[model samples]
Target: MNTTETARRTAVLQSALAKQGIEALVAYGSGPRESAGMLRYLTGYMPANTEAFLVVPAKGRPVVVSADKNRARAFKTRLGDEMKIVKTTDLTGALKEEVASAAPRGGLVAQAGEFDMTTALHAEFRAILEPYEVTDGYGIVTGQRLKRTAYEAEKHRQATAIADKLVAHAMSIAAIPGVTGPDIMAEVEYLGRRLGADQAGCWLAVGERPAETYFDLFELTEAVGPNARVQIGATVCLDGYYSQVLRIGMFAEPSDRMKEVSERLIAMQDAALARMVPGTPIHEIVDALETMIDAYCPYTRLSDPFRFQSTHAMSNSYSDPGAAPFLNAGRDKSRDAESPLVAEHQVYEVHPNFTLPDVGHVCAGDVAVVGGSGATWMSQYPRGIVRLA
Candidate 1:
């Protein structure tokens, strides 16, 4: 990523702040891995698991504060002369003090979240600030990120291609009756690491029963056998950009029921994607998906086995983009889907699956983006289940 590109993004963010009458935007927290994301958006320094904050004041220099050790690393990384690295211990207070001293008359301050502010920190901000706004900067930042600049799109394309290679390797060596899920997971990790993946995590399941949701990085399971359904996928990070893949393998021959469900699932996915073109209301697409599900696989009788929702938003690590234009299940409603497409260049991984009451499970998913042409698939993975035996 070019430093000039990052500076342009930061300027856009500052413009957003200016509209809100906020003179400065401060981002700090231990939970957000994208702390570096915020800074890199301002200055091009990708900090790892370390304490850091970005001070985006309306006027003057925008400083990236970090510990002395981290400062050395940031400097070595070549974040440009614009960044001012400082100690991390009193980072929040230090940033607040700088804003206070510089503005002197107290100006508008914006934070990523209310939770990111401690009670004391909130009080201190109020004391030093005239007017303040609690905004989700992630949304503000995501709006800029969703539309991939030519440079960003190219990087993501590389990341997606790497993920495709890893998926292909895993598909080729899929386990049969005696191989465990962990055994397969090991292969995923090896392939990813060898292919320049920053880190890879996978969930492999094989059995007659549908695999339970496995969220951990590494967990072993027993062998997959005939008549069993095996599903595996991973979230891969490459050079700070992210992509994911979800695929299914079968050891047993497909039964009539399996074939029918798989066909319906693919049809549903195609229907969903067909409605994903620009200018089509997002809810309209979501409605069509649910209506098709109900028409094809009545939910009341098959609720447990079948679940489908809007495509998931992509970010550094599945970071929520607030209200971006994409259909998603509502936070409170399990069956409710709410989202709309905002613009072209927004990326998503559409993982739509179908589960039969007793016949096992089948699913298909891949990364795609809304564009002038239409919804485009990122990877050329097979849409239906492939028999391993």
Candidate 2:
């Protein structure tokens, strides 16, 4: 977190506050399980305990509230004197005190209730603030985060590198006969940690017959047989940022039909990537993808239960914002709905998964950064089928 980055973020947040007529903004995050990313995004620090709060007033320096004083001290060193640290036992009470002290007179306040604020906590804030109106602050923060900064893009690149390494390691071990889904999953997680990833995990499915429906790695116990089809969906997080990489592995020779379908899927992925230019409407991208898949591989149309959308934005957290801007046809009513314009510096995962008529599931994608002219892939691993010995 450099001075420039901090200044940029603060400016954007202050602008948002002015637009919303909010006198103060409060964001909360519990550890990894909940709103941790929100806290990390605002303060460049994550809580070691149950919860942390970031209070940004319309004026004066920002303050970070946490239950653990020791953790707060550590953050103070990194964040410098511009950020004030407040240690308290009562998290919500401390927040109310801060808001009251900052605003004094009753004024509109915005709170990020979506992340870590529970119903009781929200009520506590309202009751404590009294006349001050509390509105949703999630959009204000996320609106600024929708576009990645250069520093953020670099962190995502590092995270995606870790994900690529994990996927490569999983593919290397997946080819051996008798390997189970959990086997590959475990190796990926282990290697991901060794590579300095904050956390990592993936879902795996393995089966011999091409027609055999894949099951979760937890529920499946059968060893992968020769000619097995494997689908691995892997994610790696580094410093609160996340990246996803999906791969398909074939243990033995692929049939002609399987080869054809895999080629078509890869082509579809390439076409989608080509369209991820800055300012392109998300609906146009989806329309082009739908047209291509329908024309090339009609069997894997949107009507198929196995088909999924090819584009999704990835950032500080996996599926941040929660609502996917694009969805495969027939899956969501908003499939054709317009989404925010694709802006430069935004990152996305282009995983297009669908099942072939007689073959199992096929999945392949990599992290990509949107560029002025087009999108550039962060993960260098090949995008097509991986044939294992």
lDDT of 2 by residue, 1-389 (tens): 55556667877797779777889887777775447766667777674356777888877788888877777786787688768888888877787778777675668888884445678776775676676777878877876777677788888899999888887888888777677777877788899989887778887767653433333556767777776677777788887688988877886677787778778877777787787888886555556666776775547564565666666777666765632545335445454454667778778777766665556566677788887788888987777778887
lDDT of 2: 0.73
Superposed model 2: Cα runs more than 4 Å off: 1-4, 31-35, 47-49, 68-82, 209-217, 294-303, 307-309, 326-338
Please provide, for model 1 over 1-389, each residue's C-alpha lDDT reduced to its tens digit, 9 standing for 90 to 100: 56677667767777887787776777653324544454444554454555455677766666666555755465546655555655556655676666664343545566653344558866765564544444455566655555555555555566678777766766666654476666667888888878886666676555676746565535555555666677776667675566777777776677787777777767766777776687665555555565666676444324545454546655444533433233544333442344445346655666665455565555666777667857777766676776775
Where is model 1 more than 4 Å wrong at Cα?
Answer: 29-48, 67-78, 114-139, 142-148, 217-219, 300-310, 317-319, 323-326, 331-342
- For all candidates in order, the CA lDDT equals 0.61, 0.73
Q: Would you list the clashing residue pairs of candidate 2?
A: none
Q: Could you tell me which 10 consecutive residues in candidate 1 have the lowest summed lDDT?
A: 317-326
lDDT of 2 at 63: 86
Clashing residue pairs in candidate 1, if any?
325-340, 325-341, 326-340
